[model samples]
Target: METEDEAVQLPFVGSFDRRDGADALADKIIRTLSFDLQDFRRGQRPGAPKGFAYLRERVEAAGIFVLLIGNLGSHHSALNVELFRGFALADPVAPFVVINDQDSDTAWSFTLLHELAHIFLGQTGVSGSKAGTPVEIFCNDVAGRVLLPAAELARQYDLRDAPQAEVISRIAAIAANRQVSNSMVAYKLFREGLISHEMWAAVTSLYRQQWLQNRNAARVKENDRGPSYYVVRRHRLGDRLLKLSRRMLTEGALSPSKAAAILGVKPSNVYALTETAA
Candidate 1:
């Protein structure tokens, strides 16, 4: 992590004077552990490996948990209340990352990076309320810097003569690189004074309303999809348990009934609840 003096030399716009000592420490830790977005997006597996135990090991090892809080109103999917509650109760001291899908892909990506900033800053047990605090403000500043560096944005602004469509196109290009949304880029540009206040307000208002409507429609679709269950099993159980169980069944190390018993599932539901990686 760079010192305050060093951070100023970086592409970020905000100052670090807002942060206290503890917050600064958190920031350092986050910066140290941070991984490239491109690498992570490509490397991440599509689903939970094997079962709950495997999931815990991978998350604990990564030192961060990615919680995708989908908008219930738009998708009709039930809120992941259980997952949220579990994290809250599990460890008050450990770092936790939480992100909300506020309708737009752009908004969601910004919020996700914002939460990652909080993790890097070393704050624990954070939520939306903490966003207003000095530490959180610093974190937000860092996230913005990372997602849309001041230098790059300035170059883009120079390339256009303030035409709304041209500005949107530039923002879209930046968002594409960051895997974020155009609205997020637009807001960033507005904050930097590259766009007029009136333009900013109008575009933001329109985007917000559209996002709300789409989110509500998604909620209906989710409700129609019916029940889906996911479990968070003990970490000690590990991915090996799932793999070994499958191998044993194949090699005649154990009977199907015995494997089902060990896994604590009925014979019929074992296939549904248990999956082994190849």
Candidate 2:
């Protein structure tokens, strides 16, 4: 909820397209951020085998991250709020990002990476639509490059003339290895022209239905109470936001009331909220 005055002024004056060297800019930002995909593949760096913890750490370091606890339907799923630290209107380094929590894990992860690309590009706007605008395309390029690198896909499935069965099998194996959904893998393959459009559409539809079914089943099992309060809060706020708020609270730099405000909970609930995030 940063005011217009506090928003980061985009580095670009007008155009946000590949012609503007968006891809090169994205590559530079990735390198500068030190997001080592090779280390992630080796599982020798970052937090754990699953990579979300490491990604969260990098994201929090790059900017202020917030997870909005609400549905955005199939559109308007994520947003970025460019906030400048201090009152310096001239400063435009780091910004803020907010993402919807209603999407399935894979979709959520994709949106997260996409928004991070925006932050790196110094772009600001709501995300989540089927359009192929230049900025959207650029962000998608960045997200795909980082999350499901084309080179990795090439290494995983070297066969260029594989049968349908072999293609599906390879996609499933790669998705499992990457800890991402098969739909994501299929989409990337389609983009890479390694899979046919027909196959991609079929796989995407099947996975979408499967995800919806699983979500409905889980909701019925939970009786609509949803996840525990702390679990929800922890995920919504993320570890970095929680740890920073907790540290500020402990150091007396942030008042309990202010912490509560930032956390969207009562002052008395701040400690408990952060505890759940632990």
* Best model number under TM-score: 2
In model 2, where is the ten-residue run with the lowest total lDDT?
A: 82-91
Clashes of each: 15, 0
Q: Listing every candidate in turn, what is its Cα RMSD in Å to the true structure after a full C-alpha superposition? A: 11.1, 6.8
Residue-level lDDT tens digits of model 1 in 1-278: 02112112211112233345433533443354453434432343333322222223333344444444444434466443223211111222234444443334445334545554544433345445544567555655665665555666767544225766766566667766455556666667776778776776666676667767987787667753444442332111234455555666666666778877865556665554455322
> Whole-model Cα lDDT per candidate?
0.48, 0.61
lDDT of 2 by residue, 143-256 (tens): 777777767867654435677678778877887756566877887888787877787777777777787799779767875555676776676667767876787777677889
Over 4 Å off, model 1: 1-31, 40-60, 69-93, 101-106, 122-134, 158-166, 219-228, 231-278
For residue 147, give model 1's deviation from the true position in Å.
2.7
TM-score each candidate.
0.53, 0.72
